[model samples]
Target: MGGTWMQVLGLNWLVLSVTGSAATMGVVVMLQSLPVLLLGSWGGALADRLPAKPMLIAFQVLRALLAVVLLAGDSTWLIYAVALLSGVVGSFEGPVLGRFGSALVPKESLGSALALGSVLSSAGRIGGMALGGILVGITGPSALFAINAVSYLAVIGALSLMRTAEMRYLPTAAPADRGVAAGLRYVRSQPVVLIVLALSFVLGSLGRNYQVSMAAMVSGPLPAAPRRTASSPRSSP
Candidate 1:
């Protein structure tokens, strides 16, 4: 997941560097997020019904495959499509990993376990971003994507080594059984939850476009000229 974020930043920077177009970067970023926004809940339901370990493995493989495909693809549309699909797969992977976290630790210690998990995740994100910037500076974004693909393989291997004997998939309770129209309807039935959901939607719709706003600002009202260095001259007697 950290690797995915690294790949995303590297890819965006690389594409923008090559195209010199902020609009393209915005489109790429939006495409990368669209699937998670659209399909994340469905992904969570699917995760509940499926085995977490295998689901994670499949998602990682899908991400790796997309990375390899992007390596071979030059078209922006191809990259966009791959990125969107990766997000969808990643949505499923997110909840699956969360469930796996529970299985990996004791029930009473779950809170501490999850806290440590989050700390490590944040560390990975920061480290991966720094490493990605260096990698992009030296080799290019495609190379970073390739490295991310391999990192996904390492994750798959780690998941495989985990014990799964007691880690059975918890059967999803049917919506009908819960006396709710659907998950959304159930959520909406609670006033606090409904308000939170509405606020989240509003924020996501407006706030998530900050990248576009930044790009526009940089290109429009606050354009900065590229810096150039002058050569030094020496005098001889």
Candidate 2:
């Protein structure tokens, strides 16, 4: 999810740079999440019915294009629109990624494979966040968006190198007889799944929500600007 992290950092920074308001930043983040709230299970079902590799690649490319659109936009509204559109692509991609793990490895090896994926995701997030900060500091938010656009090529390269003939995927089934409402019913039937979803919502609201404040902090005069002993001109007073 390096691309996701970079996208988040770039969007927050771009919004803050345009509006200079934490409230606006928070609204942008909230709008980005609205699609997930609205389209959760259809996304999951779509993932289950599709070939994982192509879906994953297409979403990443779309995400990169959305980032490029944001980079080119001059208006905060366009940036927020791109954020929402990118989120729509990501909402579908997230479930496919989870399902793809099972297809990539045997049942016996699933735990280790998942652990490895989690570790790599964590590392990618760290790198993306750090790189986003450096690029935003050095060049600007638009450049960070452009860099994020380019980063998706790495995933495309990795996918191209994989031997898909050796991989395994379940046969695509017809759409579930149940509708989206049924999907919710199915989820509610599982207490653990419901609990996890609830916890995710809580964490997203409180913990992950700090991107708004981070946007506010980084958008204007750098936080360290006043303390730049090495670069400041002589005091006039």
Candidate 3:
């Protein structure tokens, strides 16, 4: 997650530095998150079927490659393509991470584990952003990106070091209970689920993304477009 936050900052910085268009930044963000709307359920189901550790390692390697791809070129189309591809891969990888997490702890520790994971993730995001901001002054976005790529490999190393034999494997979803149709059916039966989904849709699509707004503010009345937009609210974690 630290690496992820670093890349997030670097990517937004890259977009702002190159194009200086908030709308384009918004498009890049949309491309990254759209896959979850399109393929989340399928990815969740697939995560249940795959071997957790191996798949997780593979996903990390792929993410590292994606970060490297950002460094390989600065073309607008290439950035868009990488953003879309990263989103697609992440839609699958995110679920696999959840599945892998379940294997590492017993049922009794599940709640504690999840809470800790969330806390650590938030901490990582905050620290990573602060560190990235400082590093941007020293090394620029390319170095941040390269460091992010290396961070993925560090995660791979940590995953490789885990003690697999002690992990408590959770049972996979039964065949009849898996798939998009089954997931849809379950969601339809739960009103609370529907409400949550509706709220998530509203919040995720409307409230969360502020790239264009920040860009406009920074470039307009603010008059510090480049530096501000690069580290502005829109780009912040």
Candidate 4:
């Protein structure tokens, strides 16, 4: 997750650097999320059909490969394409990892494991952003993308080292309770889920989407007082 965040921050900086256009940067960001909006349900369904361990390993590898692609060029089109591909990978990776982690512990310990995952997630985001900011300043966004690629390899290694005997696998979803339509129906039936989804949508759209603009400002017309900001003197006015 930290690596994911690092790549996220790095990609925005990369696009902004190459194009010098916040609107272009914004389009790349939007392309990443467009896949989630369009195929997220299908991703979750795919997760259910595949073995979580190998699926996660494959997802991690695919993400790593995408990061490597980002490292290869600064072409605006290449950046946009890789961003979209990363989003497609993440769409399935999110659900597969969630279910895979759940199976790692007994029902009694599941909540604690989830809480720990959440903690790691928060920590990863914070650390990744901070580190990415520093590294992108020092070595440029290409290095940052390389770091993320290696980080995914570490995840693949750890997943390989896990013990299959210890996992507490749950029964499969019934045929009647499967697919995108059924999932939507379940979400509609659960008021709490509906509310959470509504809030998430609102927060993502209104709050989180500002990163490109913020990055643009920090790296552009609204450059920071310090030289160590996302925009170097050479890149900024």
Best by lDDT: 3
Name model 1 segments beyond 4 Å from true. Answer: 167-171, 174-181, 202-237
Winner on TM-score (1 vs 3): 3
Per-residue lDDT value at 224 in model 3: 58
lDDT sort, best first: 3, 4, 2, 1
Give the Å error, residue 46, model 2: 1.1
Q: Least accurate stretch of 10 residues (summed lDDT) in model 4? A: 228-237
60-142 in candidate 2: lDDT tens per residue?
88877887887666476676678688668868988887777677787788899989988998998999888877777778677
Q: What tens digits encode model 1's per-residue C-alpha lDDT throughout 1-237?
A: 578767866666545544545677677777777787777777767666677778778877888898888788556667677767877776777777777777776677789988988898889888887888677767867888888888887888998998898664344677463332366676867899988888998998888776556555655577631111232111111
Which scores higher on lDDT, 1 or 3?
3
Q: For residues 1-237, what per-residue lDDT tens digits would candidate 4 score against the true structure?
A: 888888888877766565566777778888888888888898888777878888889988888889899877666767778878877887887888778888888999888988998899899999999998898888878888888899987899999999877889777798767788889899999999989999999999888877776876776778641243344222321
Task: Please tell me which predicted candidate would have the highest TM-score against the true structure.
Answer: 3
Q: What are the C-alpha RMSDs, in order, of all predicted structures?
A: 8.2, 6.2, 4.3, 3.9
Candidate ranking under TM-score, highest first, comes to 3, 4, 2, 1
- Candidate 1: the clashing residue pairs are none
The residue ranges of model 4 lying beyond 4 angstroms of the native Cα positions read 224-237
What RMSD does model 3 have? 4.3
Q: Which runs of model 2 end up more than 4 angstroms from their true locations?
A: 171-179, 216-237
TM-scores of all predicted structures: 0.79, 0.83, 0.90, 0.88
